[model samples]
Each structure stands twice: as C-alpha cells, then as structure tokens.
Target: MTETLQSLALSIIELATFIFVFIFLAAIVWLIWAYISDIRQKKQAIRRNFPVIGRFRYFFEHLGEFFRQYFFAMDREELPFNRADRSWVYRSAKNVDNTVAFGSTRNISAAGEILFLNCPFPTLEADAVPPSAITFGEGQARQPYTTSSFFNISGMSYGAISKPAVQALSQGAAKAGIWMNTGEGGLSPFHLEGGADIVFQIGTAKYGVRDDQGQLSESRLRSVAAHEAVKMFEIKLSQGAKPGKGGILPAAKVTQEIADIRGIPVGHASISPNGHPEIKSVDDLLNMVHRVREITGKPTGFKFVLGAYGFLETMLKSIHERGLEFAPDFITIDSADGGTGAAPQSLIDYVGLPIKESLPLVVDKLIEYGLRDRIKVICSGKLITPASVAWALCTGADAIVSARGFMFSLGCIQALQCNKNTCPTGITTHDPDLQNGLDPTNKAERVAQYAQKMVHEVGVIAHSCGVREPRELRRYHAHIVGDNSFSTSLELLFPTRSVKPEYDKRK
Candidate 1:
C-alpha cells in the first residue's frame, strides 16, 4: 500500500506540472496574437485614406508604402522623413531660426567632435556684398560670372531634377545672383524661366545635340551657346560620384518630354560614354575647350577628380606646348568625397584622392608650371562647411561650388534616397504629387536666403581669420588630425615660394 501511494503521488506531480506548462504557453501565444493584431490595426488606420482603396486602402496603402519605401525602395527616401535634417533645411531655406528645442540629439563627449573656433575679440559687422553681380577672371580674358554666395548648386540634369525644381533653382539663383549648372541633360525651356546665369556642362555622352553617328553636333552646340543666359561651359571629364564611370539615367525617368529636350530616345537606358568620344588626348581636350570658348565667347572649363595617374603631368605639358591662349579658362577639381545622385558603393568609398591631399598636389603642380595665374581653379566635392571652404581658399582654389549643401538648402532630408523616384521634399524626385509639395516660388526665395546666410557666415569666418576676402584665407587657418595631428598643411607642404615655375616637366 505504501509503494502504491508513492507511485500515485509522483504521477499526480508530473501531470500537474505538465498542465501548468501548457497553460503558460497558451497564455504566451494569446499575448503574441494580440500584439500582432494591434500592429495590423494601426497600419490599417494610417493607410485608410489613400486613393483608390476604400477603408481597406488604409491597411494596404501604408503596407504598400512601407514595402515600397523599405523593401521595394530602390535606395530612396519615402514620406514621413527624418525630423532632424529635414527640419533644419526647411528652416534654413526659409531664413528662419534653425535652433532646435531642448538639448541636441548628439552626444557631446563622443569621439567625433566638431570644435568651433571662438574669437577673442570678434569684429563689428561690415556692409555685405549682394549675392548677384560678381565676376571671376575679371582681369583675365576668359572670365565667368561669379556670385558672392558661399553655396551654389552643382550640375544635375534637367531630367534628373523635375521642371519645377529646376525652375525654382534658376529663380532662386537669379535672385541671389548665383549661377545655375545646366547639367548634361541639356538646356531646357524651364532653365530660361528665371534668367539665371547658366553654366552649360558638356558631358561625356554629348546628350543635348549628338549627330546621327553620336558625334558632337556643331549646330546643337551653337544653339545652346547662342542663348544669352549661357555664361560659361564646363567639359565634364568625370564627376566625384564615379570619376571614371559614365552617367546612367534610368528609362523610367526618361519621359517623352525629357527625350525631346535632351535629344535622346524615351525608352532606353541613357548611359553617357565613359570618356568623351571626340576627346582622345590632352591636346584634343584643350582644343575642345578652346572651341567651346570661341563659340560661346565665355569661359570654358573642365571638371575632373584626380586619381594619382601620371597623365595630369602629361596633360599640363600639352597645355604648355599649346601656349596660354589654347589652355582651358578654368579647372574644377572634384574630390573623391563628393556627393552624387547615385553611384556604386565601391567607387564612392574607394576611388580618387581626398581633397586634403589632392588639392595641394594639383595647386603645387599649377604653381610649378607657372599656370596658376592663367587658370582659375574651382574646388567642389564636400566643400559645404565654412571650415572646408576656408581651407580651399587658403590652399589655392579660386572659388567653391557646392551641390549637396545647396540641396540641403532646397530641403533635402538626406534620407540618402536620391536615386529613387519617391523623394518626399521634391528635391531629387519627379513624382507629381511629391513635386507639388515643393512650392517653387517660396522655395526660390528660400534658396536666396540660405545662400545669403551661408555666404555671410563664411565672410564672418574670413574676418575672424584677419582676412577681408575669401582669397586672403591661408592654410594656417586650419588644423588637420590623423596619423599626423595639430599642424597646418601650409607650414608642411610649401616650404618654398608660392610660384615654383621649375617643376613643370612632363614625365
């Protein structure tokens, strides 16, 4: 009887334990289902008012937007963008206070610290230069229009940016007295709307006006140059995004209107040739530059990113041989760190030299060749901040051009969704609904305001450095940190005089 009682007690304990476990698991399952149901209900509520779907549209629309924005998104930003960046752009463009409430979302003691230089005795304000009406290469024969703005938009094709966006940029730039870069997409009617000075860029593909054999057509070139607003022309050797790679505009964005303006087919993937088909050698490039200069009667320049190749020396030699008259009017150096609408990760992260290293070498090379005075150098690629711009000015750049910063001024949220068609701020997108959100009139005014503010701040920085003009900025103004820390490159790089004129050999 004792043995039987012990067996019954063990059986009862085992059964009771099993029952308890089973009840606990069921409760957990019930909670999980309830949580999932709540999420679905919230999504349904958010998407309910979407077009073409009734109440059911709410559940599916947000679901669709989520899928499209997250999974199906072709690396673009969707609606309900990040609050921090977008808010700053909106406020800056509108000339409103960019001060945020409470403390910054940043960790002050973090590893990457941005140190601002405090002035012991800040100077009083001076009469500011108006944004509009300036000239570069004034004493030189080949001069381009220069505005006083520290920030100006970079080259982006018309098809890449919507008509309204282009119109707004043109109007804004005009009001601010800054210039607009008519990207390789070709000059369009909207580019003329605001009468902004234009920098006509000729890409490797020669899209605007190519002959039947895909050669540069003189008539098309003349037609564009004939426009009174065409202030200068830029031969795009390569961009910062993919210095050696060609341009790629997807077929979806290539609408019939775009095709008509760009003189290309509507359905095909428009890929610019990797190099200029007509330009095979350095001489060919200089000849083309002169040809454009002669045709347009304006400054002609080329944009390129340096890749430690010996060809630059050879190219400079050719320029020397060709004589000063045949040399390009200007050279725009793009750093590897430059922004792009879209690019391969490998090229962006790895290719080309950084501005810090490349700028000094190129400047030294020019100084060595005694050509520094002849050719104006415009530095691009990550020249957005005041410090960076000041560094460029001190190092040797004649002017600065900014693409991404201007986009920020135009309200780019930096969602890093540029290549996709669904940009919410209507900056990089082409969708009608998205584009409508960007009021060109208001946005244009904001562009001017932001340009003025940034320029003014830069001027303030220049004054603090004891320099009245941007050209007065010197390498002593900056400090670099890396393997070597706390020293300026001016003290390190150029121990000799400003113009070398002896190391001009081609090897």
Candidate 2:
C-alpha cells in the first residue's frame, strides 16, 4: 500500500510537469508570432517597436476620456456644460437638497460671467406675487393662448428623442403646468397622449399638416387642431443649431413610424428644405401665420435665430405698416450655440447669435418698435438653470424654453450619440434594448420636478431683486462682465429704449 501511494504521487507530479511544459512552449510560440506580426506591420510605429506593451497605451488612453470626466475634471472645467451644471440639473430632477455648502465654485473672474444685483431690502416671500398669466395673440388671434409659467419645454421632435422620452415630456409638462413645443419634425401620437397643452410646430417642410406636395394641408391642420390638447401653432423659420440650413434626419434613423408622422418615405434621408418655397419675403411669412391661425382658430408665431439686424428692422417696419395686429403672436429667438441632434460642424460651432446676445437684441428691437405688447418674446437657447431663467426675465424675455435641460431630466448623459441611434440612456435612441431601460412613468416625475424647481428658484431670484414678481425683474437687476474687466450694469449697457413705455416704470 505504501509503494502504491508513492507511485500515485510520482505520477501526479509527472503529469503536472508535462502540462506546465506544454503551456510554456505554447506561450513562447504565440509571442514569437506576435513579434513578427508587429514588426511587419508598417501602420503603427509604436506597436512595431514595443510589441504588446504598446497596446496597453491605447487601452489606457481610451479609458482616460471617461476617467477625466468622472475623476479629473474640476466642477467648472468642462465646456458646453460643466460637471457642476449637470450635477445641479441631476440633483434638482431627483428632488434632492441641491444647495451647495461653502461658497460657490464658479470662476467669477471669467469673461461674460453674470451677476445678479440683489436689492438691500429684498421683497419678502409673503409679499411677492407669483408670475401672472400672460396672454398671446390677444386681439388678432381668434383663440389666444395663456400660461403663467415662465420656463417651458422647447422644440424636440419625437424622432429626435425616443417615444418614451416624448411620453415622459408630455406627461411631465401636463403635471408642471407648462406647454410643450412639438419640434419641427411634426406632431405624433405621443404628443397628445398625456393631455398636455401642445404647440404644434410647422417647419419649413410643413410636416404633419402637409400634402403630398409638401404644401400646408388645411384639412390636416384642422384635424390636429380638433384635439383639445393642441393649443397653438409655431411656424419655424430657422432654429439656432443650423441657421440658413434645414432639419436633417439620417436615413438610418428614419423609422417607419416617424416617417409616417412627418409624411416622409421610410428608409430615406429626411431633409427639410432650407427655406419654405412659398416664403419669398416677410409678407409671405405673415400671410402663412395668418392662414394657419385662421384655420386652427389658435395663436400662431414664427421662430427664428437673429442674423442681419437690418432684416429684422425691415420686418418690424413692414409689420408696422401692415398694422400691429398683423404681427406674430410670439417670436422664439434661439441661441446660435443651441444644441441639435445633427448639424454641420460649421453651423453648430459658429453661425448664429447666442441667446445671451440675441435675446436682448430681439427684445430691445420689439420694445423699440412699440410692439412689445403685441408680440411675446420666448427665448430658447441654454436657459437651463434658475439663474439663467432669471437672467432671461431680467433681460426682458417674456418666456423661456429649454430642451437640453429637460433631456437631462430624462436621464441623458450627453453621450453626444443623439445623432446616432446608439444612445445608451434610452432618451434619444429607438433600440428596443435601450428603450427598455428608460421608464417613462418614472422619468415623467423627474421632469415635473425639474420644471417646478426652475419656477420656484426663478421666483427666488426675482424676490431677491425686490420685485413683486418675475416679470418685474428688470435690466437693473443684473450685470454683465465687461471687456475692461469690470461688472457693468445691463441697464447702462443695453439701456432702456429712449422712448420708454409707461409700463416699464411699473416693472
């Protein structure tokens, strides 16, 4: 028995040695093959020189992008939106304590930094009145619209975002008492599912209410208006993302459902015309607005980014000649740096005036022409934060609309995959697996929280400015960093129009 046990141990040791030798020889052969392949490959010099070690460099570099964002980037370092900006939105949406301890982490020395001038005796919360409801298209429009919320959802199409995203926004808007603008892609079933006040958008393409020839279809317009949820119509001239350009939907993203809604062919590039073929001048635009409002019995407006001030001057002058009643109910001045699903790098980077500049410019012009009461100015660019919304109010914007902020509420990580169909958060993508991860019902609550928080905080800013309400906040309430490295009051820079209206005093 002792001899048999010894033999068993010896046999086990021998088998182990044999396996080790086999693995050693296989590894050596594989290394030799890799070395030869790397040396022969001329495409990569580092791989040729360092063999396997060089591969790790690329691996580490690939990981650095995420690492930088999560670990290395300071709160205010990132562009477009920094870590602090996104975190605020996330916390607000989750209804968490968003107040930061210690002082602000903002770089006040930075150019273009905005500062609010608080009154010594701020308005007490109890005495401050809430934002009052403002009516649009009052006398001219057969069915004018009214809403009190200053912050609202901007244009984001059902196709650009997902079905679940649209459903969530619609329900969230209804709960938050704000309106939702159905982007230029056209109205879809999800838009009306939540019984929310809807603003139907008419792109240059004429989309949902278009005939086979792409002309405005009175029948389709009437049908969409028939729904009690649809409240107003917006004629989109040019969005901020791509000025002098048109909306673009890649062939791959053109699902049959979206195509049907937009009256385009499936599996085809869904590109809108640069400008409406029928709109040769400002008169043509007014005519179109009148036609839509007449058919739908609703207030109608046009959205555009500010370009040549001369044209705006001409348009306003023309409106004056045509009568103030001919003016659009509202004008949406989109920021040049506005976000979009897809656009040429040239346009997205440097083609239009940002909201910071455009908002005041448009407002000043409207007030200059004495058309401020006739036309409401809805500013839509990057007015995401409470301070930003307050800034809009102080700078004379009647309403604020935000798209990216609401997207964040729906769990978007700014993956920048919106133009593609691989959005992992399920906010922008249509893939079944991704869509399953996003719960519309759960996200809807988050959306409502974000909107309500914005309303509340903006009111806080207005009260701090010693205003009775948000609309009362004026240019004197804010300051902009000047080129001379000093904070200059906006009232001094973009001073009140020489011919001020009596209402300005009350504000």
Candidate 3:
C-alpha cells in the first residue's frame, strides 16, 4: 500500500513538470518571434531599435492617459476641462447633491478669472422671476421665434455624434424647454424625434439643402422650413475650432443614413468647403440671409468666429446703407477654444479670438451700430458652468449655448477619440457595440437634469447680484482679474458704447 501511494505522487509530480516545461518552451518561442518582428518592422523607430523590450513603450503610452486622469491630474489642472468642472457636470447630470464640502480649488486671483459682484441686499427667492422671453426677428420674419430659455444646446451634428447622443440631446432639450441646434450635418429624423425646437444650420457645403450639383436648393430649403419643429436657420460662416477650415467626417463614420441625411456619398470622408462658395463678400452673406428668411419665413442668422474687427465695421456700415430689414435676425459669436470633432492643430490652437475678448467686442460693436436691439447676440465656446454662463450674460450675450457640456452629460470621458471611431463612452462613435452603452431614455433624463441645474444655478448667481433674472445681469455685475493681481469691472474693461447719433436716430 505504501509503495502504491508513493508511485501515485511521483506520477502527479511528473505531469506538473511536463506542463511547466511546455509553457516555458511556448513562451520562449513567442519571445523569439516578437524579437524578430520588432527588429524587422520599419514603422516604429523605438521598436526597431530596442526589439522586444520596446513593445512595452506602446502599451505604457496607451495606458498613460488613463493613469494621468485618474491619479496625477489635480482638480483644477487639466486643460479643455479640469477634473473639478467635469465632476460638477457629472454630479449635476446625476441630479445628486453637487455642493462641495470644503473651499474651492480654483485660482481666484488668476488673470482672466471672472468674479461676480454680490450685492448687500440680494434678491429674495420669492422676488426672483424666470428669465423673460426674448424675441428674434420681431417684425422681420413671418414666424419669429420667442423663447424664455437663455441656456441652450449648441451645434453638434448628427454625424459627429452617435444617433443615441442626438436622441438624448433632443429629448433633454424638449424636457428642459430649450432649443437644440441641428448643427451643419442637416436635419435627420432623429433630430425631430424628441419634439424639441430645432435650429437648422446651413454649412458652407449647403449639405441638406443642396441640390445634386451641391448648390443651395430652394425646394430643399422650403421642405426643411416646412417642419414646425425647425424654429430658425443659422448660416455657419465659420466655427471657432477651425476658423478657416470646414467640417470633416471620417469615412468610417459616414454610414448610409448619415450620408443620405448629409447628401454625401456613403463610406466617403465628408469634407465641407472652407467657405461658402457663393457667399464671398459681406454683401453676399446678407443677401443669402435675406433669401433664406424670405423663403423659410423663419428667423435667419449667421455664425462666425471673430478675427478681423475691420470686416465687422464694414458689414455694419453696409447694413446701414441697405435697409434695416436686410440685416440678419441674430449673430452667433463663437470663441477660439471651442471644441470640435476634428480639426488641424494649427487652426484649432492659433486661429481666432477667445470668447473673453470676442463676446464683449461683438456686443459693443452691435450697440455702437445701434443694432444691439435688432440683432440678438448668442455666444458659445466653453461657457459650460453656471459662473461662465452668468459672466456671458453680464458681458451682454442675450443667450448662451454649449456642445461639450451636453456631451459630458451624455457620458463622454474626454478620451480625445472624437476624431476616431472608438469613443469609449459611445457619445461620439458609430460603433453599435459602443453605442449600446448609451441608452437615450436614460441619458435624456441626465441631459434634462444638467440643463435644469445650469439654469437654476445661473439664477442663483443672478439673485446674488441683486438681479431679478439672469438676462438682467449687466457688465458691471462682474469683475475680471487683471495681470496686476487686481480686479476691474467688466464694464470698465469693455465699456458700453454709445450709439452713433445718426444710427441712434434711425433706431
């Protein structure tokens, strides 16, 4: 019996030894193959130089972003959006208590920092009223738009974001009683599904409203305007991210549905013209605006990023030469740091004016021209937080819009994969498997919560400033920090312009 037990143990030991030997041999073979492959590969210099050991560099590089976000980044240190900002949005979207425990981590004395002036006698909660409704194209268009929503969803094309993301935004916009810009991709059925007010954007390519030859089609324009949900039309002269460039959709993301909606060929990279081919001069822009408003009977406006201030003066002077009726219904000024799906590094970083300088410039120019009352100023570009929104109102923006804020509400991780088709959160990708992570019904609720929270918080700021509503906030109600570690009133920095006597008389 002792001999039999000893023999059984030896057999088991032999089997374990054989298995270990097999695995070691397989691993050695794999290492040799990898070493040869890395040495022979001409693509990567590190891999070719260091052979097998260099393969770890790519793996480490891929994992570095995650590590930094989770471990190394301070609350207020990240660019585009810091951890604190994203955390606030996440909490707001979840409809949880967003109140911070301790002191703010923000650098209050930093240059360009905006601080709201609190009044000794703040407005009582009962006295505070909702933002008054603002009318667009009041005597200019047959069907003018009037809405009380000052905070709105900005231009995010259906092709740039996933279908579920669009659906969620639309649904959320409706619930929050705000308008949704259909971006430059054109109006898809998904845009109409949530029953929200829509602003159809006309890109330089004239995508949805283009004819077979890629020219503006009056018939298509009429058809798009025929929808009751489409409240306005915005001619996108240039966006902030790539001021001199155009929209770019990767071929991989250009599915049949998106292609059909955008009036482009399927599986082809959709690149818009750098600028409107037909609308060359400022006169041509006004002409196009007049034609669109005439055909659609809806308010029409043009969006652009400010660069050369001289062109604006020229355009306003020409507006006076022509009739006031020829002027655009509204003007959307975008900031330089605006986000986009794709853009070249040079244009995205170096071109255009930031919203800090541009918003006040445009607003003062409008007031100077005596067109402030006629042209509603809607500003966008990183005005995601309540404080930023309040600052815009204080700086004279009639309304504010945000795109990345809504994307965050839809669960974007800022993975920087927007130009690629592999967005981890499914907000910007077309992959069905990735999109399955996003449920429109659920994210729609989050979207609504985020919008509602933003509006509510902005109201809180307004009340603190002793204003009855957000729109009542004036430039004097906020202060901007200067380089000398001192703060100056926004009113002093960008003083309100007095209207020219002749233009004021016309008004």
Candidate 4:
C-alpha cells in the first residue's frame, strides 16, 4: 500500500511539472512573436523602435483618458462639455440638490464670456407673470404648435439613438410639456409612443416621405401628419455638424426596423445627397416648404447652419417679392458646434458658424426684414445651461434646444462612441444587450426634471434682469468680455440696432 501511494504521488508531481513547463514555453513564444510583430510594424515609430515595451505606451494612453476625467481634469477643463457642466446636468437630472457652496470655477475673464447684469430691484416672484407661449404656423397650418417651455430636445435621429433613449425622450418631453425634434431619421412608432409633441424632420434625403424615385411622396407625408403627436415638419437643409455635407448612416446601423422607418434598404450605408436635388434656387426652397405645408397641414420650416448671409439676403428678397405670408413658419438654426451621430472631422471642426454668431445674425436679419413676427427662430447649439438659454432668450431666440444636455440627463457619459455600436451607457447604441441597461421609465423622469429645472432657472435669470418673463430679456441685460480683458454690453458688441444691417424693403 505504501509503494502504491508513492507511485501515485510521483505521477501527480510529474503532471504538474509538465503543465508549468508548457506554460512557460508558451509565454516565451508569445513574447517573441509580439516583439517581432512590433518591430516589423511601420505605422508606429515608437513600436518599431522599442518593440513590446513600447506597446505599453498605447495602453497607458488609453487608460489616461479615464484617469484624467476622474482624478486630474479640473471641473472647467474638458472639451465639448467640461466636468463642471456634466456634473451639473447629472445632479439636475437626478433631481438632487445641485447648488454649490464654493465660488464658481469658471474663468470669469474668458474672451467673449457673457455676464448677465442683475437688476437693482428685481421682479418679485409674486408679481412675475410667466412668459406667454409662442405659437408657430398660426395662420399657416391646420394645427399650430404653442408651447411655453423654452428649453426642449433637439433633433436626434431614431437610428442614431437607441430605442430606450427615444422612449425616454418622448415620455420625458411629454411630461415636461416640451417638444422633441425627430432628427432626419424619420418618425418611428416609438417617437409617438410617448405621446409627446413631435417635430418631424425632413432631411435632404426626405427619408420618411420619399417615393420610389426619391421624390416627395404626398401619401407618406399625409400618413405621418395624420398622427396627432407630430406637430411640425422641419426641412433640414444642413446641420451644424456638417453644414455642406450630408448625413452618413453606416451599413451596420441600418437594421431592418430602421430601414423600414427611413424608407431605405436594410444593411446599406444610407447617404443623403449633399444638397437637395430639388432645391436649387431660393424660389425652389420656398416652394418645397409650401408643398410640405400644403400636404401635411402642419408648420413647415427649414433648419440650417449659417455660413455667409448672401443666400439669406437673397431668400429674404425673394420672400418680399412674393409676400410676408409666403415666408416659412419658422427657421431652426443649428450652431457650428453642434452634435451629430457621425460627421467628418473637417466639417465638424471648421464648416459652420456657432450659435453665438449665427443666432444673432439670423434673428437680426429676420428683424431687419420685419419678418420677425412671422418666423419663429429656434436656436440650437450648446444652449444647455440656464445661463446659456437665458442668453439666447436675451439675444432673440424664440426657443432653445439641446441634444447633449438631454443625453446627459439620460445618463450619457460622453463616451464619444456614438458613431460606434458599443456605447457603454446604451443611450446611443442599438445593441440589445447595451440597451438593457437603460430603463426608459426611470430615465424619463430625469429628463422631465432637467427640462423643468432649466426653464425655472432661466426664469430666475429673467427676474434678476428685472424682466417679468424670460422672453423679455434683451442684449442690454448681458455683457461679453472682450480681448482687452474688459466687459462690454452685447448691445454694444453685437449691437442689435447700433449698426444698420442692409435691408431691401421691396414693398
């Protein structure tokens, strides 16, 4: 019995030793293979120079993003949205106390930074009469949209965002009494599922309403407008992310359902024309708007990013030649610094004008032509915070919209993987496994809370400016810090009336 036990123990020891030796040999082989591969690689000089050890550079570089965001990057130091901006949105969405005890981390003297001038004797809460709701297409549409909420969701396409995200936005917007713009992707049942006010976007491709030959299909237009939820139609000429460029939906994202909604074939890269083939001249543009309105009987407007106002001046001149009644119901101006599902770096970086410059320009032009009352100016571009929204109200935006702020409310961490299919938070990805993480019912409340809080705070700013309502804010109420490191009232800088903008009163 003792001899048998000894033999068994020896066999077990030998097997363990063999396994260890094999593992060691395999590790050496992998190391040698990696070293050779790195040295042979020509794309990265560091990898070629230092072999396997240099591979650590990329690993560390990737990890550095998380490290910086969590530990090193200051509150005001990140791009697109700093930690401070994101944190505020998170807190507000969570409906937690978002007040700060310490002084602001903002660099007060940043060039062209806007500062609101508070009134000596502000309007009391008791005396404040809330701003009246602005109505669009009053005489133009069978159904006009009248909403008092100043801050609302901007255009984010159905395919660009996940099902849960749309569900949340829809329900949330409904709860907040705000509207949701259905980016050029077209209307989905989910968009109407939440029963929120819907703004159906008509892209350059004319996605939902296109015929077999890709022309405007009246039957499809009527079908979409038949829904009581769809309140308006916006003809998207260009977006801030890619002004002259078109929308690109990679082949992977065009699932059968999305293809059905967008009226495109499944599993193909859906590319919209760079410019609407039907829209060549200013007359053609208005004609398209008129056709959509006549067909859908809804407020029809066009969205675009401003480059130079030559085209705008021509359009206005044509409108005067036609009539004020011929003017489109509204104009949705997207700032150059806008968000998108996917955009070229060149266009995203340098193509369009930001809202600060473009919003005032479009508003001033409309005012110059005396069409301000006829066309509601809906401004979009990073106007997420109370101060930013208030600034737009003062500058002349009839309403403000934001995609990223609502994205944050939906628990987006700015993963920047929106174009990719692997968004960790599930807000932007179509992956079912990822979508499971977001509970639309719970997130919807957060969305509503964020919108309500934003409107309330803007009202606070209006009262501080000695105005009864947010719409009463004007250029004199806000000041911008200039290059000389001194503050100048926006009334002087982008003076609303100081410089006479050329206007051809054709009447």
Best by TM-score: 3
Q: What lDDT is reached at residue 378 by model 4?
A: 94
State the local distance difference test value for candidate 2: 0.87
The order by descending lDDT is: 3, 4, 2, 1
Model 2 TM-score (2 dp) = 0.89
Tens-place lDDT digits, model 4, residues 293-380: 8898889899999997788878987887887656799999999999757889998899888898998888888777767878999989
Question: What lDDT tens digits, residue by residue, belong to model 3 across residues 381-451?
Answer: 99889999999999999999999999999888889899999999998899999999999999999999999
Looking at candidate 4, the ten consecutive residues that score lowest on lDDT are 498-507
Tell me the spans in candidate 4 whose CA falls farther than 4 Å from its real position.
1-26, 41-43, 498-507
Per-residue lDDT tens digits for candidate 2, residues 62-140, read 6786788788989999756788988989998999998989899997767788899998999997898978999988998
Candidate 1, 1-507: lDDT as tens digits:
999999999999999999999999998897666556655564554333332233455568556744664566442133323344345556767888855677777433443222234346544456333333345434433445565554567888887777878888889999987788887888888888998888888998887866777778888888888888888889999888888888877776788888887778886767888899778888888888888777666788898898865777787778777777677778888889885576788988899987766777777777767777677787888666565676777677777787776777777755566777777888777788899988889878987877676676667776676555555566665444433334334645554245543534333
List CA RMSD, all candidates.
13.6, 4.9, 2.9, 3.6
Q: Over 4 Å off in model 3, which ranges?
A: 1-27
| Cα TM-score per model | 0.76, 0.89, 0.95, 0.93
Error of 4 at 18 (Å): 9.9
Instruction: Return the TM-score for candidate 1, rounded to 2 decimals.
Output: 0.76
lDDT of 4 at 136: 93
**After aligning candidate 1 to the native by TM-score, how far in Å is the CA of 485 from where it should be?**
5.5
Error of 2 at 45 (Å): 9.6
